[model samples]
Target: MQEQKRPQFKVFNTPELLETILLHLDNRTLLVSAQRVCQTWTVLVQTSPAIQEALFFQSQEHKWHAESISSPIYNPLLVQAFRPFFPSVHEYPPIHNNTNENATEFQAEAEHHGRDEDSHFSFKALDMLSSPQKKTAYMRKEASWRKMLLRQPPVYGGVTIFKMHHNMGGDSCRSYEVQEETPQANQENKESDDDHKMLKMGHFFTAFIHNEDLYFGRFGHTRIYWSTYVPPYESDLDGRAGGSYPPQGGSYSRKVIENFAREIVRSEVVAFSREVTQCCVGGKTNLTQEESLRKEILEAESDDRV
Candidate 1:
C-alpha cells in the first residue's frame, strides 16, 4: 500500500490540445491566465496571430463579461518614464514669452476658463435625438426650446451669425449641404431619413475670445465652413457645449486632430457597447454558453474569410 503512488499523468501539449482547452474558456480570462502562466505561454498567446484572432472572436461573443473584467494592467511607471520622449497625446502649445503685463492678463483668462464650469454640458440632448421613443418622451416633457440671443453690452461686444460654406474637394463637394432645422423641420427630416440617413450632431456651443471678443458656435457646425482662424479642439459632439479650443494656430498639428479623432472613436465604442447590452439582454432570453461559443466560432471563421 505504501508503494502504490503512481506518477501524475500530464495531458496538455501540442497546438490542438491547447486550442481545445482554450475553446471552453472565457476569452478575457483565458488571455489573462495565458499572460500569467509563463514566458513561453505569454509569447505563444501574444505572438501567434491565429491565437490573437481567436481571442478577439471569443471576447466579442461574450462582451457583456467585459464589464466584470479587471481594468487593463498597464505599467504606469514605465509609461511615465518614457512619456517625455514618446508623448501619448500631443503637447499643449508653448506659452508665449511675454512681459508681466501680458502674463497677468493671460493668467486671469486661464483662471476663468479653467474652473470646472465646462463639465455642466450634458449629452442627454443628443441621446434623445438618436432615439425615437426617447425623443417623443422628451418632447412631451419639454415641448419647445426657446431660442434667445443674449446681447453683450456695447462696451463688451456684439455677436453675428454667418453662413459658412464647406469645401468638399473635387466633385464630391456637390453632395454636401448644410440645412438649418426648425423643430418641425427636424421632425420631418428624422421621419424622412429614418431608414437611410445617419445624422451628425455638432458639439455644444463654446465661447472663445477671438480678437479680444467672445465668439461661440457648435464645433462641427463651425466646420461647416473651414476657417484658418478657428483652431481645432477635442469635443464631444453630443455635449451641450463645445470643448476647450487650443491656442491660435496650435491645432494645425496632425497629432492634435488624431487625438480628437481617437476620443470620438472611444465615445463611439462606449455607445455601441451600451446599445448591444441593452438590446441583447433586455429583449429576449439571456445569451447561453452554447450560443456564445457558436458566435465565437462564426466570428473566427469570418476573420479567415477577411
Candidate 2:
C-alpha cells in the first residue's frame, strides 16, 4: 500500500489572504507579535500599503476615513506602548489645585480602574529616555514600533510638550502638558511646513532625548506657560473673532474633529536630533554618566514599586 500524504496548509502561504487577515489586527499586536510569526508575515506587514497605513507608517488621505474612526486613536505603538510616560490632561486634577474637592473624585476614579494615582501621575519633569520601557523592547533594532508614525493620517500641526511651574508660598506646583500643536496666528507659522509635520517614532525619540533641557527644562525650575485654543468651525463661526463657538462636548463635524486633533498634534514640530538618536538606538554606552545613572535609578524605582 502506498503511504498516505498529508495536506499542506497553503492558505498561510498566500500573500493576499495573509495580508487581509493581518490587517484585522490592532496596531500593537501587528507590531509586537504578529510580525514575528514568520518571514512571510514580516515581509507582508512591512510591505503592504494597507498594513502600513493601519500601523500609521504612512498617511491616510480620505476625510471619510478619518471620520469613520470614532474613538480618539493615539499612536498605539509609540504613545500607547509607553503610555506611563505620557499622561493625558485628564490624569490629574487641575495642577494648581491638587487639594481641591475634585482631587478625591479623580483619585477614586483612578483607583477604581486599578491605576495608582501616584505612580501613573507625576508632577516632576521626567526624561523619557530614562523610562524602563526604553531599556527593554523599544531599544531592540527589530522593534517595529521604532518605524511607526506618532499619529495616524499625520495631523497638519505638530505636538506641544510644556512644563508648567506655579509657586504658591514657596511650595512649587509643577506639571507637564503634552497636547497637539495649536495653530497661532503669529509669525511662528512662517517656518517651513515640515516644522509642523508629524514625526516617526524614531525621530520623535531622538528629538525628546536631545531637546531634554529645552522641553523639560534645566534651570533649577520655572513654569513653562502655554495655552491651547479651539478653532471655530466655519458653521460655528460668529461675526466676533473670539466669540463663543460651539461647546466642545457638543456634536462636531468631521472638519471640526480633524481640526481639533490637528491643533493638538501639529503645533510645533521638534527639530530632529541625530546625536541622541545613535545613543538610544545603538546603546546607552554613548550616554553621559549622568544620563546613564538617571536611567538606572528610574528603572530601579519602577522595579521596587512594582
Give candidates' CA RMSD values in order: 23.8, 13.8
Q: Please give, for residues 124-216, the per-residue lDDT of candidate 2 as tens digits.
A: 243334565755544555456655665554644333433222222221111132333434653356543343455556544443444353322
Residue 267 in candidate 1 has what lDDT?
Answer: 25
In candidate 1, what are the lDDT values of residues 1-306, reduced to their tens digit? 433443221224455556556656665555667768777667667656455534431112133255553222112221222222112111222223334444344334444565222221122223333465644442342221111111100001111222212223211101112232335445656544331122111100111111111112222111111111112232332121222222211133344334433432222110100000122334446544423433443343345446
Lowest summed lDDT over 10 consecutive residues: which window, candidate 2? Answer: 270-279
Worst 10 residues of 1 by lDDT: 268-277
Can you tell me which runs of candidate 1 are displaced by over 4 Å? 1-9, 47-49, 56-306
What is each predicted model's overall lDDT from 0 to 1? 0.29, 0.43
Off by over 4 Å in 2: 1-8, 63-72, 89-137, 140-143, 157-196, 212-306
